[model samples]
Target: MHMMLMADEKRLCKRFFHFRIAACARAHLLRRSVCAGFLTFLIAAVFCLSLFSAAPVKADDKVLRVLAWPGYADADVVNHFEARYKARVEVTLVDSDEALWAQMHAKGTPPFDVLAANTAEIQRYTEANLLAPLDLARLPNTRKQLPRFQALASIGGLTSGGKAYAIPFTYSSMGLIYDRKQVAVAPRTMRELWNPRYRGKVLDFNSAQHNFSFTALALGYPHPFQLDPTEMRTIAHKLVDLRRNLLTYYTLPEEATAFFIQHKVALMFGNYGTQQVELLRRAGADVGYVIPDEGALAWLDCWSMTRAAADPPLALAWINYMLEPDVSALLTQRQGLANTLTAPVESSDSARIVWIGPVENIQRREDLWARIVSGDRSERF
Candidate 1:
């Protein structure tokens, strides 16, 4: 009996070792396959494990394809995610929503599974039926996100069917970035920039929508995104009043940063928490970013999955992984941008307002911006 028991014990040990070895191999293979289809891979792995008692898995099978803003995803992010999950990620950058939409539409295959776009483009993509609804159950990190961000990710229109079409990534309020060395006392209101003392010494965003919204704010009308016809007209009048004082209106942050470095502009309106602030500071520019009492127009960017995605599961995995506090924190910390992750590593009231909050009635101003840019509203200026 003793000999028989000894033989049984040996058999059990061998079986256990075999199981472990197989699991390790499977883990590696699954990582490669699902890295791009993050959550989808997890589900498929479970199914595979149940079927194959001892299957070899390769790590390279899991490369997630991602499309985001320049500087949003870097080698560091890819390394971290890949190391943790044993997967790889390929990232691409885009400049504007129009460009992103056009590319995806033209390709039809949505070369990437994930895309990053602003709120306006997010709406446009969803309307064009080029986006897919996000699977919230697969994303545990979504629970950590704030309420306002949650709303932004969901489509409210009946045509949109109230589905969650995107994930809120980051946002910034339109505020002035000033050189502390030049302006010992910062201007308290948008109206202050109108003073002749700062004429031809200010930089602003070239965006018609953003400027229109800011104009509404300056006119003491409701927020630009929520403007009525009367408010729109009033804001239009305010914009014309400042045309001469404006040195130049710029779209990219780099343009403004250059001007600030050269002392070409004493004050410039910039997006809060963008890479520009960090870059300017690194260059030894005494820059101060602020959102005055008038409250500034807010803009947000989001992560959207393409409807033509080849591996929806892999895309879900990357989305869920990015929502993790550690991941979100790393992204925001490096980029100097705010994320949806609760209890981030640091905060300022300015960053807090821009990174968090509802759309805050900004869509109302879209038409206003179109009119202004087309010269239809030029008379008001």
Candidate 2:
């Protein structure tokens, strides 16, 4: 009986060992299956996430192309507009009116939706049928502008056949900027630019229209823009003489400030007016701005839409956005330009501000100015 019990125990032990081995094998297979399933899921999830990441958030997103001067469409300002409108703004800055004109007329280039130009240029653009007349009703913010700006017809070059073309944004007199240390007293007249004492120490704007206009003002011409052939010839010679005194001709205000500091320049033709003064003072220079006795040429830059605007509503929105008090105030606070909404802190009460008018002949002035800039002799004029 004891032998029989021993055999039974041995059999039971072998059977228990076999059962345990089978259980262990089953557990191992279950874990492997779970892990493989998890790996497949993870890979598929990652692929889907990458596809979503690569696609555009909005397939029908709009883009606004703007052509303007520096400080007109600053990055921060544009970013605000983009966020508010849910659109992309591409800003192209031009330093001079000539550069602006060239960009507007460039062949094979993508057209701009809106642009900033002086009233005179607005007239030029209108006559060429390059600009579309604005619907003032669409621009509600224009109501916030001063009475002078609201009455567009009262302002020259902004209307044609009783239809307004542009809305005024900012204005500044093309005054004179002088280093306070070098110029003991404020310059009394534009003639000071030609003074022998400041020769090789003066800086001038590299603009043909303005150069001729201001020189005509200094020479006491009844109509600077309406100069006859003889007056044009005389003004051209005067510009040649003025060129002899220039340290250099500058297109942008920042470039003028750089030259002023690096070379210790004494005087500059402030094409940008108080904007240059603000820039110079910020750069740690003691400078003063003055509108000469003959009166300073001023510009009233306005916003206008192009004839080829892809979206007229979007273009009008941009124009209206510019006149917003906050946006217009930024023009005054950051750029030292006077906005149409508020009174400027920088006073021009002392000097006359001659708003620029359309020239007698744009091509003639351009041609003469080109030769003058290229060092043409006085006799050639």
All candidates' lDDT scores?
0.64, 0.87
How would you encode candidate 1's per-residue C-alpha lDDT over 214-305 as one tens digit per residue? 66666666444555667666766666555546655555565556556764577777754456677688778878776767776556777778
lDDT of 2 by residue, 160-188 (tens): 99888999999999988999999999998
Q: In candidate 1, which residue ranges exceed 4 Å CA deviation? A: 1-65, 79-90, 106-111, 144-162, 226-237, 272-274, 344-381
Question: Would you give me the overall lDDT of model 1?
Answer: 0.64
TM-score leader? 2
Q: What's the C-alpha lDDT at position 298 in model 1?
A: 59
Candidate 2: residue 37 Cα off by (Å): 54
lDDT of 1 at 53: 77
The TM-score of candidate 1 is 0.67
